[model samples]
Target: MLYDYPEYYETAFSFRNIEEESRFLTKCINRFSKIDVKNVFEIACGNAPHAGLLQEMGYSYHGLDINRNMLDYAAYLWKDLPNKVNLHEASMVDFKYPIKQDFAYVMLGSLYLNDFDEIVSHFNSMSNLLNSGGLYFLDWCIQFGDPLAHNNNNRFVIEKDGIEVESEFNIKLLDQEQQMYEEVWTIKINDRGRRKQFNMVERNKAILPDQFLRFIKERDDFEFIGWWKDWNLDNPIEDENNVTRPIALIRKR
Candidate 1:
């Protein structure tokens, strides 16, 4: 599972709304955290669109990811902000920081610990990296209608600097019992007369909301600070109609 194709990943996903998301994060920090937040940490940060916003908000940003290619891409993208941005190649479950951070977050449901023990270990590691009043935030995707209904094909086209990139996604639910799904993406890049094609497969497990909440509660290091449906802080988690993803906020106890 090499994540070297950062250009394809960034083209396939939309991170253009980072400013709005950063504003919401600031609001959450103000509402939930009791201490002044100066430093921030991110786990499994791929290409780090949010870290740019954190830097603009005057926070020293440190990001860790298991993929070396992604870290390299992040370093390239954030090269101008060297003083404020730092990226490390590390795993989510076994990474350490010299100084304690005031806030930590993982977005886009990237907390991919499969088992309970792995979840506990990741949470404990995060708790150890945070100060007493620090906050840890993450989001989980919940199936509202049917878990099997997500099997479909989608296409996207992105144009930049007179070059067009076309991406086709073939998605399927591989195993319901294991909460596993697979996506095969076929990408075509057309630059003038030159054309290139690449295919990649991505597999991931869908972690349920209740299971994650239970895991956090079982660990005494963090206090559950409630969850919101989607990006709206005013909306509660019970409102499933508007929430495709549930965001959980926890404070280090």
Candidate 2:
């Protein structure tokens, strides 16, 4: 099963700043109007913390995650706002519901996957999930444009409640044509010399700003708004600060 390790799932909690993320999304949302974005949907909404903010803002928001355990935890944490906030165990690729929404969000590069065709299908699906004048905001990773770089592998180890868990990540380039990378996630738990292993592999396309713009531009269902290259909402596309992770917005046209 995917995301079976409780420890790794817990580790992911620290990798993001939920409050800052919420603020960033809110800034984007404020671009349109103050009218209640009455209905909101978030795909790959791990732990669903962002939905909490949306709920506080008086929006009816739904959260969806591919991991069952993550969704279960979200349900427990957000039990008080059950009506306003609902978390589902589903992937962004195929999740569907009856009601369309005023806004939809997919954060933290979670949309990256093995297939470009599947990714396009998902973008289209998400566009369909929004209302005519609705918005879909996405924050994703972009290729480091530096001329000097190489395949990188990294590891993080932490101790919580006396349990030592180690997580290893390997990012490998898949040649030049596709500009894709295969990510290998491995987590190991060790207690008094006894170790257990859990692993997951996913292939994702590494995006660049130009390519990203072209892809979104070619889609007929949506109109490309712009991108935030380094968190500057105004003129974010050209503001490169050594690295570029873009937050792009689109309106269902």
Candidate 3:
């Protein structure tokens, strides 16, 4: 799988502006967070992309990922930082952490629950780790449009450090009633003339805007803040058709 090769995978998705994203996250904490965020946790964190950056800002960093290679690479990548980062090998749904987190986030819609029951369990676990007034930020995790109509974003190419990586993403409905989807990702990499290909498949449970609101309403530990577009607080999700890069935040009660 592409995730096994940390260098190639980071290069493939390096288009992300980490500095801008880190700044936005800090702004969110300043603008919306009710408590002083001392430490941050990342779910399904790959390569710990924001580890060093967030650490530099004085917040301790912690991340969890199921992939061993990703965790190993993240440890090595941030090993020399002044404040050491905590890396854990576990699934996001029910991972256990003794330390309480002030802010937690997951990027790129990596929430892969199989059903509503799992979703509930995931939230339950999250509630255990986050203290009151903590915030949970989700990016591209809510479905506001037809996944099948996202053909324009299915194919992309990226180049970094003499390595060209091409990625193709396709989604197929697995079950209509359950809102389950099968995502197929094909990655082609050329590392200084060494060509290789990798394929990965994952199943995800899509959480719609209304459904997510209702889900949080049914729970007592969390309160839905709101969902936005393009990472801008001013650009609230007004129209489903124009929902590009949806971002949602929920605060612990």
Candidate 4:
């Protein structure tokens, strides 16, 4: 099940800098495309913090996710926004929108589909939804070696208002042949001394930059722009081992 614990999902990654992230995305759209980016689409927008900020910036935001729980949470998060914000419960591989978008993005490792066919299908669907010369951006973490062996486990404790959240993350390589891994997140929440705990296990594939570039080149609907090591557009991806999350920017042909 995807995003089984929406509460834990909200708590685990609660500290992300939404303003900076949205600004980065906006900068990318401004620099790469000639169209005025008023409508934006996001694939697997969990909680949609970025979309909420983007909507506040006067863009119409549309977010799609297969998890209804996540979409409901995203709706609640964006309830106070003034601009148009729409949340849809749909899979990225086969979703069809009524209108074409000027820009689209898939943040985090949400672009990791089940297999090569699913990846291709997602790209095709996304390309079909974008106008000519539009932009599509995606980012994901690349695992070079065993994450557990490298002591990559994380523990986060966040306290806000009257609630306290403690989250522990454990990652393990599940299959070597398929280049797959699983991340188990255990979250403990204390709200006014009332304690609750839950666990969410996420399975993802480690797709290298070369593999993604190859896929983009194979498709005629998109043209490869460039890639960044992390979030900084100035820093190109030189060594995959040095960077945890790499971002790819492409344009629809």
lDDT of each: 0.76, 0.70, 0.91, 0.78
**Candidate 2: tens digits of C-alpha lDDT, residues 1-253:** 3355444465544556677777777777788523347888888877777777777776787877888887877777778874646767766776576788888887767775556777777877787778887888777655546312323436778765555678777767775677777777777877556777778787777766677778878888877777766666765666463353567787887
- Model 3 Cα lDDT, one tens digit per residue, 1-67: 7788999989988999999999889989998899999989999998999999899998999999999
Candidate 3 to truth, TM: 0.98
Worst 10 residues of 1 by lDDT: 144-153
Highest lDDT against the true fold, candidate = 3
Task: Give stretches of model 2 more than 4 Å off.
Answer: 32-36, 82-84, 144-153, 157-165, 189-196, 239-244
Question: Each model's TM-score, in the order given?
Answer: 0.85, 0.82, 0.98, 0.89
Model 1 alpha-carbon drift over 4 Å, by segment:
141-147, 168-171, 191-193, 239-242
Tens-digit lDDT track of model 4 for 49-162: 787678777789998888888888888877887765788888887778898999999877676576667777888899889998889987764444355653453787987667
For candidate 4, the lDDT comes to 0.78
Q: Cα deviation in Å at residue 14, candidate 4?
A: 2.5
For residues 110-155, could you state the per-residue lDDT of candidate 1 as single tens digits? 7766545666677778988999888988865443444344344367
Q: How many backbone clashes does candidate 1 have?
A: 0
For model 2, the run of ten residues with the poorest summed lDDT: 144-153
Winner by lDDT between candidate 4 and candidate 2: 4
- Residue 103 in candidate 4 has what lDDT? 94
C-alpha RMSD by candidate, in order:
2.7, 3.3, 0.9, 2.3
Q: List, in order, the clash count of every candidate structure.
A: 0, 0, 0, 0
